[model samples]
Target: MSKVDFDEYVKEYDELLNKNLSFFSKDDSYFCRYKADLIKQYSSKNPKRILEFGAGIGRNIPFIKNAYPESEIYAYDVSQKSLDYLEQKHPYAKVIREFKGFENFFDLVFCSVVYHHIPVDERQKATNDIFSSLISGGEFFVFEHNPLNPVTRKLVERCPYDEDAVLLSPGEMKNTAKAAGFNDFSVKYYLYFPPALKISFLEKFLRTLPLGGQYMLKAIKR
Candidate 1:
């Protein structure tokens, strides 16, 4: 699907996902807190330029902005509705046109929950786009579904993602990041509580543990 249409679908879907995607969002939600922590850990060095691909409803922007208030934040998506919402939520943001060529323009590029939507043939191109856009020594942080989790794998198939969309095993995630020209790659699994309990206490407690239900990958461009 075109990015514009994809964005539109999510604008209508954000609420549904917020309620349904329990493993990813509980209390502060994995993405919210993860982005915040990422900002705290990495933004201190002050990356002046940032870009977010498939930034659905602009959820990560507020937290990311907290750390880099002065940095220019660029959001890109295919959905006009979602982009409209993003623009409304983040007036300071600049919406990037499609295929803007991210080469060496961003110190940090955030792509969350998007790879799975790409077709198989396009997955490498997407990775290449991310790689080409990052500056040498830049960082790309991805938080994706773990195929190792049987439940997650099944849920992904049911989701409105492209057929090529597949969950990534820890090793697969690391290897893909490396192939994308990112080094010092690390993958951490998260979200390991029963979905019945949608509270932050469990998430906070579970996050302290090394293994969880979901997975996050941190890769640095070298």
Candidate 2:
């Protein structure tokens, strides 16, 4: 297969994402809220700076902003168009095309559902970039589709923009983090029930199950 042109792919996805932003709204689903909660729990107290890697259209902006209210938030993505939309929607965030001058600049970095779209060979470089973006002992929260979940598989198959997506298992994510030179990290499985079937009382119990639609890898930079 030919190498996927991520720059072009991102631009196309930016347009699609803008129109579908409501689907990712935090208030619309427990999944979004739960992911945000995880981010809030793992990040440092009063983080000085935060970066949201692959923050397409800034869907996680509200959650990150609320989580680190006192911190300077930066948004990074491959698409300028997506960053443009994110900037207009979130004027306070500093949008960047690359992590060029940001080595060791952030206390926390949140990456959500963006890695599966990355080509396998390029993931190492992406992981290393994220590792470099954070200061020593900083936190990196990575969320991705759980390949073990049937629903997740179906959703990825049905989504038009996800044509190139290759879901990563929790083990794959953990290995990527470890290969990036991070020895301190833990993987957590979450979101067992979809919004329509979600029962609030059972969420805590269900979170222990590894059959959720997605999983998160929380790594600390050394």
Candidate 3:
């Protein structure tokens, strides 16, 4: 797949979101709830500093802010337009294009649905940058589309911005983290059923199954 100019896509990003509001809302709500639970469960101590990698338009800011009210949140993206919107919408977050001066600074870094947009050849370098930005034992959370899921694949096919996306499987995400020198890692498959069909009990068991619409990989910097 060819690399995409994300800056160009940021112009129509909100339009696309409006068009697919229903579809996007379901995934967003599900992930936000899931992330809240995951953070409470995984975090050993209160995170004082947090980074959102590829934080386009700051979609994850609200959830992260509410989850960790005391944390200083920062957003990073390649699109100035997106960063502008994010800064306007979320004044609490500091936006940046480069990771300079942030080595071993963040206690946690969260990335969602961004890796697929990155070209395959550059993924390792991107992961390394993320790894370097984290403090030792700090956690990195990555959420990505599950290519094996038919629903996920179909949704990506219909989304215009996803044209340049090259979906990565769970194994690929683990390899990316490992290549970046992260040793303690874990992966969870989630969102087995859409919002309408969501069953709490069933979802619990389904997490073990890799057929969910999306998967999350957590790696701790060692």
Highest-TM-score candidate = 3
Between candidates 2 and 3, the one scoring higher on TM-score is 3
Candidate 1 ranges with C-alpha deviation above 4 Å: 1-11, 22-30, 42-44, 157-164, 194-211
Cα displacement (Å) at residue 174, model 1: 2.7
Best candidate (score: lDDT): 3
Summarize candidate 2's per-residue lDDT along 28-106 as a digit string, tens digits. Answer: 4345567778877655556898888888877788777876788898999886777878899899999988668668888
Clashing pairs for model 3 are none
Least accurate 10 contiguous residues by lDDT in model 2: 17-26
Using all chains and alpha carbons, the TM-scores for the candidates as numbered come to: 0.79, 0.86, 0.90
Clashing pairs in 1: 3-78, 3-79, 4-78, 4-79, 7-79, 102-133, 103-133, 190-214, 191-213
Steric clash count of candidate 1: 9
Candidate 2 residue runs with Cα over 4 Å from true position: 1-30, 196-198
Ranking by TM-score: 3, 2, 1
Which of the two, 2 or 3, has more lDDT? 3
RMSD of 3: 2.1
Q: List, residue by residue over 76-187, the lDDT tens digit for candidate 1.
A: 8766777788888899888875856567888888777776666546666677788899888777777777676776766766665334465566676677767767788766
Candidate 3 lDDT, tens digit per residue, 1-222? 666666776667766755654654545455566766666566675888898888998877888888889999999988778888889999999898776777898999988889999889989998999999899989988889999998889888888888899999989999989989997777777777556654644766676688887888888997
